[model samples]
Target: MSKLLGLGIAATGLAHFAAPAAFEPVTKLAFADDIRNWTYRNGATELAIGLAIAAAPTRKAGFAGLAVYAAWLGKRVLARR
Candidate 1:
């Protein structure tokens, strides 16, 4: 389980970093001109949480990351709802 978690988190973090940067003019402008801000921010944070979870050496770390993820995901869902 630990192995899988570590790999998954590391992979996602690498992927996130490897991906191209957002070419748009304003990341903060999404609220006014685009819907990208909310979506992108949530996606970015989830990856961070994934990295956090993967780096965790114990179940406690996983749980903490999961809690953070839930909170972030919940906010995104609520925003769209």
Candidate 2:
């Protein structure tokens, strides 16, 4: 289950890099400039967390990190409305 979740998150991260334009709106929520850099940074963060979650030794910490990240993103999205 952990592996599956990790892979899913990682795939999304990869998608961010593959199609950063699609993520620009979300990036705009936190940044007014250099959106591409922010997008890449976010992608890197997700990639790291996903890799951590996939690794047994770091799975717990990764899940915790993911929870926090998700909550933060949710807040940002809501704040935009």
Give the per-residue lDDT of model 2 (tens digit) for 1-81. Answer: 999989888888888899999988888886667989989988988988998898899999999999998888778767766
**TM-score of every candidate relative to the true structure:** 0.47, 0.80
The local lDDT score (0 to 100) that residue 9 gets in candidate 2 is 86
Candidate with maximal lDDT = 2
Misplaced by over 4 Å in model 2 are: 74-81
Error of 1 at 25 (Å): 17
> Local error of candidate 2 at 65, Å?
1.3
User: Per-residue lDDT tens digits of candidate 1, residues 12-57?
Assistant: 5444445524423322333334545444554565566566565655
